[model samples]
Target: MERTAPRPPPAVDPLRYRWVILGVATFTQAATAFFVQGIGAMGVHLQRDLDISTAQLGLLLSAAQFAPLLGFLVAGELLDRYNERWIVGTGATVVAAGLLLGSTAPGYASLLLVLLLVGAGYSTIQPGGTKSVASWFDPSRRGFAMGIRQAGLPLGAALSSAALPFLAGATSWRATLLAGGLVALLGAAVFMVFYRRPPHVTVPEDGPHLSLGAQLAARFGMVREPSMRKVLLSGLSLISVQCGVGILTVLYLYEKASLEAGAATLVLVASLGAGVAGRIVLAAWSDRVASRYTCVMTCMIAVIAGMAVLMTPLGREPVPASLTFVWLGFFGLGWYGPWLAYLTESAPPGKVGFALGMVMAVNQIAIVLVPPTLGLLKDLTGSYTPAWAVLTALTLATLAATAPAVAAVVSRQGLRRRPPYS
Candidate 1:
């Protein structure tokens, strides 16, 4: 009898449909982030109209960020248990309602409350989108898809940057805020209408499920692994990048660059636009590079950020002003797509959502912690140079840390192999 070759197991059809979910996911990010980030565009207006001090304005901006920190933890756990459409759609509605109410907010206290809602809004997008995207794209295409999705954030910021400043001029700040809020509601409806979670999976062999205490312990256990530890460090890098881009970039342009407020806003907005491209380019190309794309991102970020920090006469002239912001924008925003992809991929399949949440949680903690620390540094030193110096050190430290991470990943596989990308 002829020996029969073993039949190739029927290939499981991957979740190609999840890409549609990604499309909707993009809008949700754009919608929610627009309201929160629009503050930078309207800062001058808020200062003038509300008669708030710079520090007070910073607090309001920071407050929006603060509420979202807790969401990383809560949303992560909930995502693991619930239907994403309901969770995300509901969060979006709440976000919309909060901003609408804030549009007519009578006092600083009300504005703060509205901002709290904005943070809640931000919390939904990532936990929902990250897990959703992971289901559709394989590890190969992940960098691209995640990058594209992340690009929405910059797209949203750019839209707000371009539109809010002009809109603020055209009508009251309340109108601008209301307009953005309404757009977010539409985002909720779109997500509810189109986004679907991947079907529930049951492996032929069920692994032991993690209890709450067990899960936390497992999380710490995962963290202790050298590869996972790199993911966490990358996540911290993410936090610094977020602080630099989302909050500090525009401020750096306006005050330090001494550009007129409108021009400063425009330059920073241009960078946000570039981020949309950077995400697409860097992410898609990540799959083809010699090294795993994360390494490239790690290297690129260190070089660009270090140069930006040391570009000492940064805003002293127009050439440096334009170049620095563009360079800063590239480094600051470009890393999100890959680092997030890296974080998602590095995680075990069963625990991916929770892993992502942990990263986001750390990211939020950094968000809450970093801006204030940077602010205090700026306040005491009376210059951002010292602040930039500190960030520069951290950036370099991240670069040095990558070697061990790559080595650990290699040791696990044994012998030289192709990078994770094809």
Candidate 2:
């Protein structure tokens, strides 16, 4: 027989595109989250420049979140129906424009209006990003991929938290806002240029759009799923803890630890930096253990421990306080990686967008409620002690909530050997 020439590999490997999706998705997430995450670092600046109370400052954070409350569901339906490239890219452009306009706002309410626009744009990014990356990877590797993508939030936060303090110090908060807007625009540009759906994924055909009644029915149907219900309940408590950590850390340090504003922001930077690493590490760990729930539970435990320290006399001492905050950052922000991965895994086939949007919308309820509530607590008591105690309590509550939720999910999965058929 004559020898045959060896066949060459395909011109483009589908596996390779998954990584491109991850890279662009991660960067877009970072850009979208940058200014919002820096709210804690910018706390002192906003307070002095706007002459706002802690409650008012918390409201600024909440303002950016308010529109997203409903926006996620709308974006979710859009993601399922449209190309993510356009949806995510256009949304980011909106973010840049809103932030640019926000920097020029003459008063607090105007700034809040600008941020509400930013939130409207941002509502698409999370579900869109999660849907983008989840489509690219399979179950085995999904946890790790989701971790890297989700880590973008804290990475952006850490970088901005570190730089924004100095940036605001150098010129003005308005200038800082302009720079952030520019960064978001860059992210939009980069994502538009680099991102494409995986080759195997089909683009939906243009057709009659979902009727309002149909869309509402579909959304309600997803919300009624048991796994989703559990995720919603679990995220409510945990997200409250996460949002509390982000909104309160800087103020807690400046007031409670008696640190200078600069020192406190630096501590906030440290917390977010640790969070970046924790997202990656715990996510990778989930890939290894084959259990996202384990990862979430572990984070809840660490958060409880970190919060306990914060309530102690030891947490009031500067060194211990710094370390405890870093610990909180690790678990506080880390929990989302596995949490999202679990959500992605549990979603009904072909409805990843709806699942992500719906779960996060539920999570937004806590995000909207927690920050200002904590700020109000601090304002009323004139101390962070009550606030920290409240956070500790929330974390403990999440611990109680997570265990049965995870068990229910696992039991439903039939992960354990099924009982002998009758």
The C-alpha stretches of model 1 lying farther than 4 A from their native spots are 1-16, 199-211, 245-263, 290-293, 296-317, 408-422
Model 2 bad stretches (over 4 Å): 1-11, 43-57, 103-107, 165-172, 203-215, 253-262, 382-385, 408-422
Q: What are the per-residue Cα lDDT tens digits for candidate 1 across 143-248?
A: 7888899898878776686788788888878887799789989999998987765555422212367466876786557787666777677667655755765556
What are the lDDT scores of the predictions, listed in order?
A: 0.72, 0.81
Residue pairs whose backbone atoms clash in candidate 1: none
TM-score of each: 0.85, 0.85
Candidate 2 C-alpha lDDT tens digits along 9-61: 44566577778889999998899778887876788888988899987886787
- The TM-score that candidate 2 achieves is 0.85
Q: How accurate is candidate 1 locally (lDDT)?
A: 0.72
Error of 2 at 87 (Å): 0.7
Judging by lDDT against the true structure, name the best candidate: 2
True lDDT of residue 3, candidate 2: 100
Clashing pairs in 2: none
